[model samples]
Every structure is written in C-alpha cells, then in structure tokens.
Target: AQSVAQPEDQVNVAEGNPLTVKCTYSVSGNPYLFWYVQYPNRGLQFLLKYITGDNLVKGSYGFEAEFNKSQTSFHLKKPSALVSDSALYFCAVRDRADYKLSFGAGTTVTVRA
Candidate 1:
C-alpha cells in the first residue's frame, strides 16, 4: 500500500516570498510521487512528479520537488509565490508495483498581496 501525507492543513505566505508545501509518503516498494494544485471549481493541475532520474524534479507553474529516498519525502517548493498561486495542493504517491495512486487530504495555500 502507498499513502501520502501533507502535515499542514494550510500554508500562508506573502506575495513574492518563497512557498513550500511539505509532503511525506509511505510505500511497499519504490514510490512514484506527484504534486497537484487545484483552483476553485477546477480540476487538479499537475505541478511536478518524481518517477525516476535525478532527485530534483521540475514541472509546471514554476514548482519543483526533491525526492528524498531516506526520508520518504517529496516536498513542493516555489522560489517566489504569486497571489494567483493560492490554491489547494495535494501530494500523491503510488507504489511502483501498484496501479492505484493515494493522495493526501490536501493543503490550502493562501498567498497574500
């Protein structure tokens, strides 16, 4: 089984400041981690993914994540946040041998101007 956790329920940051959404996972085998953001009434948008290759993975919306095997963490980070970046963020993970993807409860981010 695979599961993901976003310890924080909400993250508040000022515009132009760095933003981070923490995530940790547990899996039976190797894990495939992913980050998604959802705006109000919108579907989840892919932010980043860590399947293989380098430890650092970059994806849409100027977001990046680092895959830490030892700690089983893949926290999302943005160098600077924009007011428009406010949304609900999700951390998901799937065991390499499993077909199901388990997602966290989600963390809401509010970027204030």
Candidate 2:
C-alpha cells in the first residue's frame, strides 16, 4: 500500500525563525513525492516535488524538502517563517503504477508574530 504520514498535527513557529513539518511515506515501488499548501477556504497549491534524482528539492514560497530514501522521510523546511506562511500542509505520494497521489492527514503551520 502507498501512503503518507505527517507526524505533526500542527507546528507553531515564531515569525522570522525557521520551521519544519515532518512527513514520512510508504510505497510499493519508487514514489513521486510532493508537498502542497492550502490557505483557508482555498485549493491546495503545489510547493515542491521529488520525482527523482535530487535529494534536496526546492519549491514555491521559500520552501524546500529533503528526500531520504533510507528513512522514508521528506520533511518540509524553510529558513525563515512568516505570518503569511501559516496554513495547512499536506504530504503526498504517487504510486509507481497508478500514478495516483495519496495524501497525508495534513499538518497546520502557525506562524506567530
């Protein structure tokens, strides 16, 4: 089975500090990893994706993620947090065969000033 797990239900960070939201995944074959963010009452926007090759992948809104095959993890990171960055985050993985993405429960990021 293919699935993703976001260990944190919510991550609280002070503005201007770095932030991280943990995620782990399980898949039968090679996984296509993705990160998406959702603002209130809005659709999810793609942050980044780890298709292959690169272990460190950068994406929109100053966000990046490290793909660790051994640990089965892809944790989202940002050097500086902003209040505007507060939102819901989701980790997703596409199955090698079906190419359908299965998403994690989601983690809410709260950046306080």
Candidate 3:
C-alpha cells in the first residue's frame, strides 16, 4: 500500500520568514512524490515532484522540497514566505508503476501580512 501523511493541519508564518510543512510516506516500491497548492475554490496546482536523482528539488513560486529516502519523508520548504503563498497544500505519492495518486488530507498555510 502507498500512503502519505501530513503531520500539520495548518502552518502560520509571517511574511519573509522561512516556512515548512511536514510530510511522510509509506509505499511498496519507489514512489513518485508530488506537491500541490490549491487556492480558494480552485483545483490543485503542481508545485514540485521527486521522481529520482536529486534529493533537493525546486519548484514553482520559490518552493522547494527535500526527499529523505531513509526517513521516508518529503517535506516542503520555502526560504522566504509570502502573503500570496498562503493556500492549501497537499502532498501526494504514487507507486513506481501506478498513476493513481494518494494524497494527504492537506495543510493550510496562512501567511500573515
């Protein structure tokens, strides 16, 4: 079975501060990891993906993630948070061969002005 867990329900950060959202996973084989952001009443937008190679992957909007294979974790990070970055985030994973993704419940990121 493949699954992802987002330990935080929400993360609140002030503008210009670093931010992080935790994520852990369990899967039978190599996993295709992905991060997505969703705004109010909108579908999820792709943030980044970790398929292979690099442990540190960068994505849209100054976002990045570190893939820790030994720990089975892929946590999202940003050097400087923004008010516009406040949105719902979801961590997802799929088996090496399967296209069906299993997503975390989601974490709401609230960036204060």
The global C-alpha lDDT for each of the candidates, from Candidate 1 onward, is: 0.94, 0.96, 0.97
Task: Highest TM-score: give the candidate number.
Answer: 3
Candidate 2 Cα errors over 4 Å, as ranges: none
Task: Rank by lDDT, highest first.
Answer: 3, 2, 1
Per-candidate TM equals 0.98, 0.98, 0.98
Tell me how far the alpha carbon of residue 76 in candidate 2 is from the true structure, in angstroms, after superposition: 0.4
Cα RMSD for candidates in order = 0.6, 0.6, 0.5
lDDT of 2 by residue, 20-113 (tens): 9999999999999999999999999999999899899999989999999999999999999999999999999987787488999999999999
The predicted structure with the larger TM-score, 2 or 3, is 3
lDDT of 3 by residue, 1-113 (tens): 99999999999999999999999999999999999999999999999999899899999999999999999999999999999999999999999988799999999999999
lDDT (C-alpha) at residue 26 in model 2? 97
- Winning candidate number (lDDT): 3
Regions of model 1 farther than 4 Å from truth: none
Give per-residue lDDT, candidate 2, residue 48.
Answer: 98
In model 1, what is the error at residue 22, expressed in angstroms? 0.3
Q: Write the per-residue lDDT of candidate 1 for residues 2-109, one digit (tens) a residue.
A: 789999999999999999999999998998899999999999988889989999999997999989999999999999999999999999999988889999999999
Q: Which stretches of candidate 3 lie over 4 Å from their true place?
A: none
Model 1 backbone overlap count: 0
Candidate 2 lDDT for residue 1:
88
